[model samples]
Target: MAKDHIDPVEELRQNTAQPFEQAHAMPPSVYTSDEFLNEELEHIFSKDWFCVGRADALKEPGAYTTCELAGQPVLVIRDRDGELRAMSNVCLHRMSTLLHGNGKTRAIVCPYHAWTYNLDGSLRGAPAMTLNEGFCKDQYQLPQVKCQEWLGWVFITLNADAPDVSDQLAQVEEMIAGYDMTNYTEAFYEEHVWDTNWKVLAENFMESYHLPVCHSGTIGGLSKLEDMICPPGLPAFNYHTILKDEELRIAMAHAKNDRLKGEERRTTYLLAIYPSLLITLTPGYFWYLSLHPKGPGQVLIRFGGGMSNDFADDPDIDQNFADLKALLDDVNVEDRGCTEKVFKGLSSDRAVPGHLSHLERPNYDFAQYLMARINAGRGN
Candidate 1:
């Protein structure tokens, strides 16, 4: 007798139905199935806002970066007027990508055929095209993608009808106003393609439960499980607060910072912005990882970090950032190992889910968010 094949969407519905206390991890197939990943791409990634990186990274005119979103090549650039714009990276003539990576360029010239475009995506010059009788460069322009800057982060979307990201994250703005997140200087940024399901890494970041074990060599000793506070998530995001041990002075407020008071001075916020932005914000520093699925078992990560203005005037600022960057690099190594192992386990036929821990409220909430986004506009 053949066993009935289970539908991934059906499993997702069942997982999301359980109350937080009675919740269990999502089905292993959700992370390992190619069919489910395609569905997510069609729905969530295609229609929702995706963060690329900090706004300040593209501060100068002609600064630009090339990336892929929802399988479309995208170019994010600063125009001659110093304004951020997102456009199709595909050239108008024969479809060659206009840019490769992050750098500054006075104009976009296709490497394949030398088709030139202004920073604003206007067709600037096309060599030898004038020989053709009916060709007009004025008629060609790269299609624009919707872009907005929110709290110092640059987000773009292919869907024009999607809600504004700033309006969607109003609660987060109110909650972290004391920290003035926009003023945090980005000291370093890097891109890494890791071997893991994007969702697996996202869930790993949503909870502190794994820290004491998975991150034992780096940040584990500083994270005490008892100090964590996990609450039910809101629609746009989920977050957990941790009270840092005062011995970790950088996690505590500096003398220059007067906006934070009481526990706010000693608290750290771990924020999971729905779909794929993960942020770790402390009183003195902030770091975030924005993920995009590369395949069924791979993820592209845009990782960056910086310190708050309070530490801007410290005499040892250079040494302090060097030490901080070193620690962050070590943390990334631990996290990559842990998340890749989870993905490997999920690939096995015998893998089954167990009940969620009380501290995994965010993961349960994340399941609900995923189901809601995937099933939306489908009339399910």
Candidate 2:
């Protein structure tokens, strides 16, 4: 198949290396061309630390789930020894996907030839292999991938040289230390496929510029442009703060803790962890979106959230979550409408880079990160 290609690194560098007043958005081809998407898959997704899910999801020894990373089938399982393992999901015999979706399994059994594997990915049993010559079971284990845990989230990478997830997110950890995220229980999780580029969804979450416009009916009424504070981007992530109006600040269902101070009680922090993790933290709760590109115009979104431990035992917890979920659903609908329209607009021949607003500093930082990865991959 012939592939459509674009040199996004050069285009991004040209568009972003200027004063904020003079800078423009990224080129249309960077979002619409299959060639650039392929490059991102190799240079960014393949080498970066990708967040999969919350660590609390795998509560049992045999709990497991499957996903694809950079087009490679992969699985994460909790072994009997209480350790999490990430490895290829492809079977050694016929290359069939070993598992589907998620479940509690005593052992991984391939549906193709009935080849079986232990919870640790070691080959446990193979039917009708007695006639084979010099087949050693010890040598047939599934290949392991690099995996790490941070702030109760599971992250994995295909590249052996990728930086440690903990090191990259150290500052973010310190900033949110008052949240006590490790003790936050998983209240809910859901997945959806959006008809927009992965970067489109990511950029949407990174900036607060649209909150007053796009989300007017839901959250916009409570936001003010002057209250937003955009922090300088760190080497590994970018963050911004939105202050809540005193009158609009509703008392949290969760009990207040001393770790947070006056402003912290009225502030919301939004963080973009480089390539794909988008997180939002509030005094009462937190939520995140882990993005995966399915194609040039499709993104797989894993969205989930939970309340802080202060509200873990609240009698009205269920009602609180219901209200939260409904608000989130409405906000998502508004965002989807805007992003899908932007994707279509990018396909037009007249499409070109537009001037960015002061509120879009995080988007500028994201472009820099994208360009750095592409250039590094090309050995430039």
Candidate 3:
């Protein structure tokens, strides 16, 4: 619970730095280093809490879903008692995979040895192997991963020793507590495979620098280039800029709606959870994107819970969402194109690590945060 506590939100309120300042960009090699990427998988993605799926996916008592984080396959299931559990999706005997994809299963049966596991991941049966001496189901139970459900999202941690999820995401939780996210639900979920490093995707989500050029069709008309971005100096990982519709802004002005008039409205709040999770919220809905590093040149992006259930029945909701999704598609594709170029260039002899820009203080902070973790791994 203490991890959920945040520092002063309004501290260092003004930043006079320019947007593309040198201090903001991460070093060039972060995109191309297979060694660095593997270290991130171990220290950041593997150990930290990640939102794998929604609790709604496992609505039935025996419902189940399988996911992978940093190449580690995971299984989440709803038991007969209605409790949700997560575990490694590998069979204990010889460590073979158990399930292929997501589905409801009364018990997971390993194709390799025909070992079976209960919904809670306890050893259920190993067939004739149980007849052998010193073979005990209790000792062979599937390794359990720490999992928790909060704000309708299911989060799992690969490291049993990692800090609690709430503590790890405390600043994000505090900033979003006023948004009433409990009323939201997933109306759209899409995953894209990009030929870029996962860090590039995380950088793309942290700032709206390319909104006018890339997302001109959807957000260009409504978002001012200058106002659409937050000034530097806010907490690097938790800053968000809200971009509101002009009509919505005028209506709020006439009605004196306190929530949408000031910083809370007409802004895009871009938050980066160190390593590879990005949370962005708009007036109509919020989008949670998790970037998984598949390899040195491949990244898998999972888009989860992009709509509000409160407006599900509204006639205009679908149209508005369609436009938003279209804009995001354009933005994401544009980013992919650029990142892939960067990925290819990282191997160039000319490409070397560089300093961050002054306006890019947040990016610098994020890079520092990343380096701190990387350094920790070397016992430096």
Judging by lDDT against the true structure, name the best candidate.
1
Question: TM-score of every model?
Answer: 0.98, 0.95, 0.82
Superior by lDDT: candidate 2 or candidate 3: 2
Question: Candidate 2: minimum summed lDDT over ten consecutive residues — where?
Answer: 246-255
Instruction: Give the RMSD in angstroms, all C-alphas superposed, for model 1.
Output: 1.2
C-alpha lDDT (0 to 100) for residue 291 of candidate 1: 96
What does the lDDT read for residue 217 in candidate 2?
A: 86
- Model 3, which residues run further than 4 Å from truth? 1-24, 229-236, 247-265, 352-359
Give the best candidate by TM-score: 1
lDDT of 3 by residue, 177-265 (tens): 64545556666667778887777767666666656665665555666655655544333254646456666422112222244446565
> How accurate locally, in lDDT, is each candidate?
0.91, 0.85, 0.66
Instruction: Write candidate 1's Cα lDDT for 1-380 as tens digits.
Output: 88578788889998899888799999987898888888889888998899988988999999987789989999999999889999999999989888997999999999988999998999999888878988899988999999999999999999999899989999999999999999988888899999999999999999999999998998898979999999999988999998888877777888888999999999999999888999999998899999999988999999998988789889987787788789999999999999999999999889999999989999999999889988784657
lDDT of 2 by residue, 58-128 (tens): 87998987889999999999999999999999999889999887778999999999999998999998999
In Å, residue 373's CA in model 2 sits off its true spot by 1.0
Ranking by lDDT: 1, 2, 3
Off-target runs (Cα >4 Å) in candidate 1 are: 1-4
What TM-score quantifies how close candidate 1 is to the native fold? 0.98
- Ranked by TM-score, the better of candidates 1 and 2 is 1
